[model samples]
Target: MAANFGELFLTILLIVCLTVSSQGREMMEKKYPYLRLASSFSSAKARGYDYIIVGGGTAGCPLAATLSEKYRVLVLERGGSPHGNLNVSYLQNFHISLADTSPKSPSQAFISTDGVINARARVLGGGTCINAGFYSRASPSFVMAKGWNLELVNESYPWVEKQIVQFPELAPWQVALKNGLLEAGVSPFNGYTFDHIYGTKIGGTIFDKNGFRHTAADLLAAGNPKNLRVLLHATVQKIIFNTRSPRPYAVGVLFKDENGRRHKAFLHAGRHSEIILSSGAIGSPQLLLLSGIGPKQDLQRLRVPLVVNNEFVGKGMSDNPMNTIFIPTKGHVEQSLIQSVGITKMGSFIEASNGFGQSSDSIHWHHGISSAEIGQLSTIPPKLRTLEAAQRYAKTKHEIPREAFQGGFILEKIDGPLSRGHLQLINTDIDTNPNITFNYFKHPRDLRRCVYGIRTIEKIINTNQFSNLAEDDSYTINMLLNMSVKANVNFIPKHTNDTVSLEQFCRDTVITIWHYHGGCHVGKVVDRDYRVLGASRLRVVDGSTFATSPGTNPQATVMMMGRYMGLKMLRERLGRRAGV
Candidate 1:
């Protein structure tokens, strides 16, 4: 009896020890709340979500993170995850990401019908995954102009900044660029703040100390993972609508997985359940048009079944047109993206990137300049049509020496461009890239502003501060300007002082900074609450709904819109419940 009792006691002790050890192991193993998938997300069908967000880019990621705190959320991204993509996570690969042409690459390269070459992100983080990583708050004037609740917008800025924003330790090249801007009278030197001000300011960046980029995807860390489901490579084809009632309601979305397998994700039958289109300027409008929610004439032309006659769906497309000035340095400069910005009173923003534009052979400079045949477009006046004709005549005769170090400054017209462009459907196919026409420099004021920007960059390079780093002389400037022009055609430099030549130069050299916005303007396509006009349970939370371009790098503003909209939706739900 004593031996049996002792054996029983030993067995019980071993079981207790094993149970405690197992519990400790479980505690140490961290399981993220969100379920991430590359394909086969059919489980989304079984469990309907409270919120279904399309295009898991900049705006969608943060919005999902915030909304998931209270509601079940699904983010369907058309591209792959940026988590392990070096081209997306590293600051040095900034241009390389944009230059990537692989079909599966996150950055989808496209040329506008007007002949401008640019790229839009197809990744989970959207533009933040591919952009220069510059971060800044929208100007107060912009917030007020949009009639946004300033208090709410202010509250939302910190939520995004805390996760991704970082003050860059100025690289040597950025430091030199800052001095040059100040010497050239950019003024006031707003140090380290994210405020959008007219001066030489060192703004925030997304790149961290180790040079790893912290994108909008990081914001998901603050979310309830169990409430959020992020499906990557899930391309949304169209929004499924129920027109049984007078007002058409977006009930769900039809998206395709990586294997081109179709999947349907539906919003729960809850009172506040909604489908938000945060697919960005181009993607949002394109998706809307594809779903037959655009101009009646356009929808009829494409033989799409009409859902709404909102003519403003794909109109009012505006992008910040940039004119770049490249400078070749004798000594090597540390490679950096946008760090210091020269916000000029002249209605243009001047910013520089180091170690880019080093190779004339790179796609950003070579193919970008050559393939853009803006001359064929009818938007240009007959007089300046010679500028387009010049594209065929211009040729890049002298390539910059491979050993020569190079840096360049970009002049962005951000105050408010007078010219407005449009995006139209080429077909009903969701996979096909839309026809984008950025009628650049259609207005005379836009042309004058770009010319002023180029001259201002010239002044900065000529300043004593940049003299040691830049080639200063009319000959050098003219040669560099001609090189940019000739990349489009084989034209010779003529009448360098004449306004016609300068205007021609502006027309030929201008490219998109990719701050495109306003295909779904607030007063036109969507209400102030960002809900689509003449529709129910649908909203646009990306740059697509901007009234006008905010005069800065727009990533911060786009994220703020997502945050602001997410909170506003929550408030609206509460108000409804209270019968307010």
Candidate 2:
């Protein structure tokens, strides 16, 4: 397996190097002059920064760029730069990146307490570097519900779209998926749109026509290079607080570099200066808890110094549950990621992908077996599965030569799952994943939505558009769906029976679309302006603050929110300076 990866890595590297012209290489360097290694980050400049943004991710990158337009901004990313990483930069290597179990891999794999295997972005671009690259704006209702200035939200979307989003030319498999969706009565076809309309539509992708992925890290090119300083491989251990004042507030952050050298980055004394946490859903809350701002009992048990004691810090956690079925095709299907989507009013989103597999030399290590290769493990029966077994099973699912094996997946994912969970710290290590559970199907409504979504997928399979790709008429696509939804509850904790019902299948087969949001939510943890309720000069501006996952994919809105909120903050600062 190691030998296989080495050859694959070399080939991918050669491809990436050839694809990037000299002019392109020069442009990238010039575009991000301020980006540097954490070792080069000088502590002398700590107090000079106007804002210290943790996590140079989907929200953090744009936020730093926008703020750097006027202020001295610092972005500390725990991961390395995404500039030349073949796994992060190429569309075909998506699953390979996630399958990489190395400590420095761009995708950080983790299992939810609900027994679902998931991943978090460990690269500068965050999830944008590791995601399916689907791009679409949030629904108007989503904007309205968040009480955002709809005009500003509208303006912010274009700012992000212009930089990274692109209209994807549909692959043959994508066209088939679109036709099948429409044939299944999803709705009026909305072709080549970024709007989140309830219909079959072709959405934007971050991967350009050349199949090179453009991540949020690219947004840093928009920053004022002289004012913005990006520090890579800087893991922020905790937020330093100033308790001397009547109101406790953040003063700086204590972070460590790759070499384990600790450093402190302090904010300028400016009244509007702040420490923003764009460390993502799992990250933001975990940081807060580590910093002694979460439930008092948890903090006390952990023996951390309490700062504000906000119990809701890690509350309201939710993940969109997805159920998928494999569709093996006899003929060739071109490889593609998410492009076509069907947004049903029934609170589910339908999507598909095809023709992703590894070469014969590395078939044993191929990671494209699980659905769209999102690398899920919950699909395996819990009682018989370990992480290694699940991963090994996923990788070696295809025994035939790569060319001989061909298939795709049709997936249905429930939206805005009402089922919620919480996150708790296991230890103080900043790099350690906090214990989290989505409590999938805890609410009966979530199960019903899953059933509805799965049934819609059945309708799509039954359509002639999809039948064209199937191996034969005898193939039963809905075999799993036909199973019962009820049985005596005899399973052990987190384990289920082999002949599970559809409802049990929804629970048993549940996996993350990696769109999990809410560990710190709006109103409960942060205000309308995204300011932490009980803390000063601290705010979380990422998916962690979302009450509901936006649209089909939240990256667009996440990027938009970063820009929108940064503009708002800049205006506020300018207003205060002008004595407004």
Candidate 3:
């Protein structure tokens, strides 16, 4: 696995196109002068640090910076560049930020191991570097529902806003998006707004004063303490344990360089090291599995020793259903500035145009109902399911007129019918990317709801308000209607007129976000206190540690978790929050 990854990221040069810059080379060279060629892994094998967090992403970034004020901290992100090369700052710049083919929303745009490709940033700040900068207010009740005191979290949020996630002003963008929809009769209001305080149609992202992407990496750049050191393009491959006692204790991490060369980072738990896995949901789980801390059968099959036999190790994996709706706007909206959530445009209905050819970052508007079936715990869906779905959608026949593409179109894909997937180690090497397969849209009803989502969008768009955009010529609507009837025959997606079955559309746009969860859930790996259930010296703090599924976004949630866990760590370390 180590050897494979070394070759994989050797070039380390992303071949994406952000804008029509005549000279991208000059731009890259000027911006990321610290870029490294694929070389042997450089090692930092010191025997001590106060805290050593693996997978420095959403959670890790904040935790590392904050904790470093009082303790020595080390952050290891498996991907490249910590400061976030200018290219990775904005998502629309994805063409330049990530060269990987896996699209963020739809499954049709990828091949095997494509789920990983759908994600971004192996750099210092993790997903924040590649995310579409949408900030959600923490759901107070939701946090309280998890048995946590929402007050403490609530208290921390404003401080977090000032220092970390800069929730943006959205009225202008909202007004712009909504006013157009209203003029066209597609929306009730002049712009979008949120109902719930936290759920207020989502606000935009935290861009810097100068308008560059404000990522965790950027936050780290400004206020981070000198003690927090970030190791980029580095992967932590193993947890070396002190097995002198019955309960094994973690002592150090084994890492591999880009050349596949192995090195041991000696972290003495008390004097120098406390390990935290902040690699978001996917990366954290894979790190554990690779470290001999997963299911017995998987360990046996892989010829790896089993140090801990936790049945729910990689189970309960989850992510939100992200359905997309693309509406042709009256004017251009900032393609990159993120207005995360907006209400259903008044009369603007959603229609699943399960078409094959389209870009992924188009609008992701509208939510779908999630239906879950807890099949036998062993009935997890395989990678093959997604592959088959993609194949089926790709080989379709359709001829919808161009006029139909003028308005908004919904691409409903994922929802809670969680036929889950798991993380397994290909080998015991930190350099390897996990073998991840999001068995997306595994439930038939889940598929139906996705199609329904699109239909809803179409209905909203065709509202009386949008009558202005409707074609007066019966020829266009009739042609579109005939095409819809024919298109609905075999699979879901695009059908003509306002009268197509959503069931068919479900068969069209099913995809995954590659953000799987539940590998080290509270009940399994960690107890209610977040201490690794059976071990005293080990703990998990990333998204992998989430106990149950939260219905909305998880980036800020992940960061909050890190802050929570860090506070706990701070208390424990000092013997209280202002601990000794």
Question: Which consecutive 10 residues in model 2 have the weakest lDDT in total?
Answer: 483-492
C-alpha lDDT (0 to 100) for residue 256 of candidate 3: 60
User: What are the RMSDs of all candidates, in order?
Assistant: 10.3, 6.7, 9.2
Q: lDDT by residue for model 2 over 1-580, one digit each (tens)?
A: 9999999999999888877755564675575688777877778755557999999999999999999988899999999888988778888777877877798888888888877778899889899998989999999999989889887787799999988898998998789889999888998999999999999999999999989999999998898898999998899999999998888899899999988999999998877889999999999999999998988999999899999878899999999988766565667688888899999998989998666545334632222324324456444644334577666655654442442235667778999999999998999898899988888889998888777777777778778987777777554534322211111011112222222356777877676789999988888889988888888999999999997899999999999999999888887778646321
Candidate 3: stretches off by over 4 Å: 1-47, 82-84, 98-117, 164-202, 208-211, 221-224, 269-273, 328-419, 426-452, 464-500, 513-515, 547-551, 575-580
Clashing pairs in 2: none
Pitting candidate 2 against candidate 3, the one with the higher TM-score is 2
For model 2, the local distance difference test gives 0.82
Give Cα-based local distance difference scores for all models.
0.75, 0.82, 0.50
Report the C-alpha displacement of residue 415, candidate 1, in angstroms: 3.4
TM-score of 3: 0.71
Against the correct fold, how does model 1 do in TM-score? 0.84
lDDT computed for candidate 3: 0.50
Count steric clashes of candidate 1. Answer: 12
* TM-score of every candidate relative to the true structure: 0.84, 0.88, 0.71
Poorest stretch of ten by lDDT in candidate 3: 370-379
Task: Sort every candidate by TM-score, greatest first.
Answer: 2, 1, 3
